[model samples]
Target: MIPRHFKLLLLGAAICAPIFSSAQKIKAPLPNWQNLDLKADGQFGISTEKAYNELLKGKKHVPVVVAVLDAGVDIKHEDLKKIMWVNPKETAANTTDDDKNGYADDVHGWSFLGSAKGSIQYDNLELVRQIRLGQAKFADPKNIAPTDKEAYKAYQKMVAELQGKIDKAKESSNNMLNVALKFNSMVSKMGSRNPSKKQFADYSPEDPAETQLQKIALENWGTGDFNNFMEEEIYGAMKHYREQLDYHFNINFDSRDTVGDNYADVNERNYGTGDAAGPAPDHGSHVAGIIAAVRDNDLGIKGVADDVAIMSVRTVPNGDERDKDVANAIRYAAANGAKVINMSFGKGYSSNKTAVDDAVKFAMSKDVLIVHSAGNDGKDNDKEPGFPNKFYEDKSGEAAAWIEIGASGYIDDETLAAPFSNYGKNTVDVYAPGVKINSTMPGSKYKEQDGTSMSAPVVSGLAALIRSYYPKLTALQVKEILMKSAVKVDHKVTVKNGDGKRKVLFSDICQTGGIVNAYEALKLAATY
Candidate 1:
């Protein structure tokens, strides 16, 4: 069980490096692209300009509705204001559930974290609870012995898995410390209060000054674009280093063991209360701005969809999301008329698989499309699975609306697929621009970020584009169109391995092996 206290700390932030693709060399650029994040660039407006010039002039489809499920959105964001999804049944700012669905004045969406206030949510909250319960069940020393031997073996396996996480956390913390120390030393040697790369690089490579600086730059921070160095980037390493140290060395992370309450108790619909101000609204607001923040408004940034509306459902807090909350969020999006849903989060453990899967099934039944981020752990998803997968092992369903996307970059062929993006031909469906992605932050600010979290919203905008222009297609069909029409890359790319090394020929990581092209998807949809 992921404890409540830990959950409060968990919700947050991916890195992308270049990888090899089957396409041996970059001869031609992928053409007819559409959908640049509004928060990213005024250039993204060029993509929208193309959409209008080529596709939108003659189109008459209704505006699309996309739901962003993450931290709460800054409802006051200028770009996000007009398009906010209002519950028609209830009056805004009034203390009545005019819709009478138990939730009061849920004009935009409901916040689940406030109700489960103290409890922390982890990926396998339920699974952890089960393991704990089994341990408590038999006080007898004889009970400790495996009855069928198989029983003892199962327990052993579970224990080993939990122990693996403990090991990894420790390892990660150590690595961060090593990296952080290197950076600290680099700063000390330069003696420059704030050493930008240029000042540091004024020395020659053969010179001890340059050699040491280059090695330090590569080892500590990953890149050396001095001009583009984010405030978050320079300090993020220090932050990561400290946070990991606490996670591993500290005895208490209260969020670690919270899998209590009958998660399966579906009859109890009053799962959470009405505190919409989630612990962190950063990721959620960033996602929300991507899909439907009004474009060409000269505000912080433009969103992908023009006439679309946004449904903000604050479910994720600082850590892993509760199964009950996730499931309910899905149903809420579907019931509230959201045509598309974007989920930019995932965890390895899902204690209440039954509830989680049920929510997915319900979404599919309602024909609502879901876009998910392939986790940022950088391991091949095929070898390391993340929870809330799009397809069941059986592969029985012909049409699955859920999509798992990896990160891409606006850089050249060399930096195409980010080294950190999770890939698996069977698991990751596609890729999108995630490296140095610019989007809306809380407090109505515009900022740059990196992660599959950014990637999911880029595609969500495209999904909204397709659905907006072609409403006739069902959610399942739209998902298929997006995948099937994706521009596949034949380049043999380079990707980072589970160990911090690089590996080649990782093109097969994603089924599509291509960055999404909205223009192509829309063109394909027209035919369908």
Candidate 2:
């Protein structure tokens, strides 16, 4: 069993100083992180010394591999380029499957969205579509087949969920329209169409036309750089707002029809095909930069691990991902010798969990570790279930090496867990910094995104840190070590309930109410 005080020691270096340089073998802390040490000379690179001695001074563990199964990585981001996993046998753009692994030109990894038919966004409104079409299809006397009881039941649940999405989408869409219209009206009096953030910030309302337009712009997008805020800056905001509208408001549009293939069909492998460089893969690029992005290159942000290789497996879409794609991506990572898998995506439904579950089991059997996001919905999830949980087995001791991570903020507790993060009593193992996190995005740009999606990779990065240094630990052991020595938080912070109200402590939200601190984990790694 894992020790319980992992979280009690999250206050600061003072509490962690006791475990320094012990003879016991345990996880190590960041020896001297240049970023964490506020009091350092002109020198750069690692800085904290005392914490390092107690953590990673003399640790012994296995070098494990992590698999990142997300939209896809840029693979070229300066910080992420060096560590991208390379396929030794496969030739790039040669039009031949050199590795004989079914994917063509899979130099880095596989892409389930490589084809057009497989590249549809998540079915945020699938339940609504099923529900709207259900009664018509089921009640139609001339229909060729009677309604499936099980399918109907499933559809019913999804439809109820659809109602929720539709309501949310409608509300957000209306709010956006209101803001846009208000801005339009304000600008109308000023005789201007659209103004940038700079213009709005510097303008005076006394100018009649200019003033109205400025007010409109300020209200709509605020006094930020409207001309350029990076793609993710606006895109991330838009995505979240739209999801709020679709999932929480009154507008209910469905678009699950675009992706024509059934997600349960493993035989349907060759579906999506495209160059990894596309408009939709912005999320993947940013995540890649965080995991293995090249460091000390005087580039953008530094990745978590050095001496790393990233595998770009494009399995996620703009919305809910299909089970088949997720499963196939896992297999691709495992087959391509991927050491780690980072999954920064999730949804509330899975039509075919068996395939994804089996693939997770397969990866664990092969000693591969899978890290995933706990999701962005701010609801207490101990009452709900998220996809890709592998802790259970069929009366056997065999369990997949899986880690479910929640989002953490710069501040501890309440603020520690990103309000949008989904939590579980025993399912989610840990949390990491995910709120307003600064990382790489698409278009050679960097921005901040908030979600458990971002939190998962940080844990994956720490896992990679352990795996890269100590390769002997199996996937399960790594998961145990991470959780066992986690910074167990006991602070009673407020949480956002489903009704969007402040509630109680975060412990009511996740399995273990603590964040994944690499520093502390390293400390345990050194002395455990």
Candidate 3:
């Protein structure tokens, strides 16, 4: 079981850190990192290209369905449209559940964030919601029963910590927005849409404010080019702040109403609409592309797997995904013949962990492998409970089909571990290339996104490849083989430690102590 102090450590680290590695610097926007050979590039990449060229040169494998439970995928994405999974039994726009599986018109996959009316865009974090619901009863410890006393204490602690985080997020958002506004005004007045530092270096501003703004821009933006500094750094920071204020820290918002389901009842089914791609499709689309963007299409980037069908399970929202939605998404994927499920979203708190556990069990029963991101808290997950984990909070074994993944960088340097990746020798199974990962975005766009969110799908894509080629391997077997076949590295590494950096053995972070390798995994699969 995770110690009580471990949970507190998670809260502290999560509050201090950004959701993804802010230290992630934009390199050449390319897709080679995810498939780079370790020996050639001095990277911890999965050797996806090598696997395709050598191990899987003449292999003809069956198509495998991979469920992506994320903020919602753009099923109509140019590179993803043809490779997306379509329910053969369900008819589109027919006003009937033709599949007879409690879902109607689930052509690509089901959307659990919506109802007949519309879809949700925002929601309260589970910690905030829990505090609000139990605040009155736990106001005074004197009235609480003995059995409920521990829970009451936990509620109080969580309330205090989460509230602090919300306050900090609000302050950060205000500061970033203010800076962004100032920069925007300065840029507009400068007359050049894409002005460079060299252009500003020669100018002398009459206004004091203009002088100050110019100085600020030169100091920060001069080091990097103007376009990159604005679009990659400042704009990215603004988006992060906006998401924090409008979604993660919003307490009064309730998206469940849009879903029109009793969130308390995990048994509730078929309460969502047909729009699998919710209001946001960027995150999920990016994830989908990492797993199975159309290969050899001369498109933006080729995915790791060639003949894989991406099942778009839209369960995640702008904020934390509810346990009910997650449970339903897993079961839906399992029932619909998905060999693997990639969950790129996770929360620190779970209101109904048992519900998710039961669903995981159901998925495992149907031989569905689950791949999850270890989170970006920069804390040890063996001690902290990242919800939807391989084991329950009580330390009881839950699912053998699950693979907990941590993010790694392409280069083999001191900053090998992605600055934001959560790791644990016992909890995380393997590491994957995540930093500055270029993949498909919504509206036929392509962008570089960094996070464990990207790493999980890299493994998911590999898992699909293995399962497709070796159809006889069970979910548990695949999980084990992936772990055992990982390219182990025996060296000390530097990882994030809240405010400071810490050096630790690579083995201390993840069980494999190395990076996931598609070539190695395929070779092992052949043996199986």
TM-score of each: 0.77, 0.76, 0.88
User: Candidate 1 or 2, higher lDDT?
Assistant: 1
Per residue, candidate 2 scores C-alpha lDDT tens digits across 464-494 of 8777666766677778778876666677655
Order of candidate numbers by lDDT, starting with the best: 3, 1, 2
TM-score of 2: 0.76
Clashes of 3: 0
Error of 3 at 506 (Å): 1.1
lDDT for each candidate structure: 0.64, 0.59, 0.80
Tens-digit lDDT track of model 3 for 1-528:
011012223222322333322223444423568888878665668999989989898887999999999878888889999899989998999979997988889988989988887888767677777877787777776789999978888987987888797777676656556656766776676787777787776666665545655655564452457677666555566566566667666666666777778877789877887787889888899999999999898988889999899998888877778899899999999999999999988888888888889899899899999999988878888888688787765567768889999999876776778877899999998999888787888899887777899899999999999999998999888998899988886777898777798999889999989889999999999987
Worst 10 residues of 1 by lDDT: 8-17
Q: Each candidate: RMSD to true structure?
A: 6.6, 10.4, 5.4
Highest lDDT model number: 3
